[model samples]
Target: MDTNETTATTLQTKQHFEVLDGLRGVAALAVVTFHFMEWVYTDSSKNFIGHGFLAVDFFFCLSGFVIGYAYDDRISKMGILNFLVSRIIRLHPLVVAGSILGLLAFLFDPFGGHPELYSTGKIILTFFCSIFLIPLPVIADRGFNLFSFNAPAWSLFWEYIANIVYAFVLYRIGRSYLLLLTILSALAICYIGYRSGNLLGGWSGPTFWDGSVRISFSFLAGLLIYRSNWIIKNKLSFIGLSILLLLAFIMPSSKWNWLSEPLVVLFYFPILIALGAGATLTPVWKKICVFSGKISYPLYMTHYAVLWMFGNYYTSHKPGTTQLVLIVIAGLILLVGFAYLVMVIYDIPLRKYLSNKRNERLAKQKAGLI
Candidate 1:
């Protein structure tokens, strides 16, 4: 390829913020734990990881910073359609994979689930909508989640939306305008938190728009962190940062969620992102951090499939305290292993194939232009 042609291709092989990647994995683990506890505890106040849902906010904020860092400069050269296809290739394969797992779990959930109640037409539509990231919350058995088959896919839907908006609107704006938007989004988050009690909307049909505001602020804050050179060089290292991130998840829930949730999302997470981007990674932790980051997304997307099954099993069997403890511990280990397998067997290979096609298509387009 010529110089111009090469410049037009994707530049995603750049080095990552390894510490941030590790924190993401930590947060993903917290989310899975939270999902498990929510089924057993029902009451947030009793759940140790009551605030685990905030991990999604952290993901959004991290996305903003990473997206800006990765694409803000190169997007102009690669163009919007190519940028989006690159995102789809990176993200959608798992979306499809997760949806399929969820569908299977829903149908064959030997523990529970009444799939026979829904017609074939409804089930088919739900599956297709999930693959396309369309919001369809009609499955009452599944808490009417926006994507019943794979509930966590709800955030991925907003993530796709944010990517499109960034390609068109976010990248071109000056830092001042970006800061202004971030502030406005922060205000919305506070209002939503105060109105509802916590930053845990956007996964269901009724609270769908609630997710929009949740992502809006966190993503903007993250993007601003990158554009404004907000990196905070620190010596806490990945271990210390992981502890700090976990505190937010394990925090006690209370009537104070309205105040505390927004504060964490609006301030604590952005600060952590900055610190994570700059924190040192010890040689001992390097491989661990890399593995954590690589497995984070797959863990986040795929764990929910088992979560539905776990919920049914929990309700049907009502395992004793000892059994519940063992089940959850084993569940965490097995889920992590499953996520690793999916990453290797399904996600990585598919993304590699799709990315190759994307490069070839770009090359052909470049030749046509020439």
Candidate 2:
């Protein structure tokens, strides 16, 4: 533990975080694939390669780990308000922009299709649910129904839920208690997912409870990984991915399905830890994954809308595979471009303003009278 060794380790850790970011990019791609391929998935077998929904889970778990690492000190000292402000500022701007874009996309579908998709009830509800990030099954049941708008944003609801739990319960209780609570909560979600009959109902069903129960494991598993100091070294990424793939395939689709939920929960933890670990272990991975991580949020938020726009255009023409591929590529380009635009225009500026305002108010309050 001399200075040289410490210096080398520090550099490695920084590199690893960059790789974790790249994995975030990978996760983003997964979900985007899932969205783009949803129409053709039946033909492609149930394998569902894009299965980006799983990426959302990865993001949540990653968030739990990153938040634990990033704000453990802040939570320990200045408390929850500042922690919450930072999160809100970071999250809300993109969310708002995504929602607006989604609304516009749905409103102007290429075929002039499903205008009522933006009916008063639906529009108001979607806006309201999104504002709170309440995992409402607003449009998922439609199944290739691009009209419901902002389909992927559903996961953000659970993100908010997990954050609330983290801020109030997990942080206050300390890592040990947080671990206990996460385990217990994960078990509860598993039971609910099992009892509720697989929990993936048609878009018409109530989304809040079903999705929250199904995905809480992602967040909890993340917290578990973060609390353990062993994860810092990059020893476990591929081993974790293999286990998840094995379980995802071998595990039956049966309701409650034996160890399905727990398996998923178990599989997810290691996969993410391994992802974080690999960045530490390998330089190449670190370089690619970190770039992906930086654009990950915007990619996740904008991809669905971009897909809907381009996918609708292609579906109308009934293009050849080459055309579809070109369209898909175009869609991806637009997705990333739009995401970056929203991030730069609405997301970054508002976040800076809000964060600054919050910090200034906090500073003033500390001096006595506000």
Candidate 3:
């Protein structure tokens, strides 16, 4: 998931919607739990959080809503170049760090598998490409997929494409046209999800189009929700909303007669976002929201690399239920701690530095000093 900022005017006039922020964190955490379960079960159908990958779609919708909320008013003034720069500053730092972590993990376990898989030169190449969020071609012989260092980076690549679409095309379109696009994207989502039998096909090379359709539908739906200024007026419980989101992710797709993923993406998620927008939090809930928002992005971008480490350990050891449970508990703590540490030590500081640099550059450009 990505974080977005408000325009100067919106910043002055609009209250930050903390519920959406908290939901993002909730979804990220679900993803982490899902991955942990996936490694343990090694069977998608048997996994506990069977539909947790839907969190990625939730993330796409959230990104669209926040981006539209933040930038819709200022698109004309900000210009495409500036908008792209702003997104890069917000998203690229953790991406680079994640890739580096992935590379280190690979280096430490280079000989664990087929020695011919990734040569040192190939690993270095993957590292360099990953920093720029490039998806390398999959090497079937070696079982390599794009962003080999960190698989989750695949979503960030699509997110960048969606950002470009927003800045260049979607921002300028009339509401009617945008609505048409949203409807078409929704249909695409249903069709793709039905054909694939699941919504989990997006991270690999052959199924990249499946991923594309998934993002397009959710992102556009989110953009439409923001543009329509839709929100539930009745007081909604933050805890209730949180539970609904978790259930949406945790429920098995087959439990809803195999229609859960499509229904959730096409209807539930957008409705959820609207309801979340209207949520008013108590002081305690407010702090929860703030802390959740602070760690959501870092958790998402960093957890997979840690998971890889966990997977390595799991494969090497044989543990009983109690021992396995302890490992899971400790792993969760370590993942959360690492995500927060990255936020405090790297993500926040790097974004701030990049933002300051962008401001300086923009100042220079305005002053004809560039």
TM-score of candidate 3 on Cα atoms, chains taken together: 0.93
- What TM-score, computed on C-alpha atoms, does each candidate reach? 0.97, 0.78, 0.93
For residues 20-113, could you state the per-residue lDDT of candidate 2 as single tens digits? 6766676676667667776544432353452344455567677777777665545645467656766778887777767777777777766534
- Candidate 2 yields a Cα-based lDDT of 0.61
Q: How large an RMSD does model 3 have?
A: 3.4
Give lDDT tens digits, candidate 1, residues 75-176. Answer: 887788878988999999999999999999999998989999999999999999999999999999899999999999999999999999999999999999
Please report, in order, the local distance difference test score of every candidate based on alpha carbons: 0.91, 0.61, 0.81
Best by TM-score: 1
Q: Which portions of model 1 show Cα errors greater than 4 Å?
A: 1-15
lDDT of 1 at 181: 96
Ordered list by TM-score, greatest first = 1, 3, 2
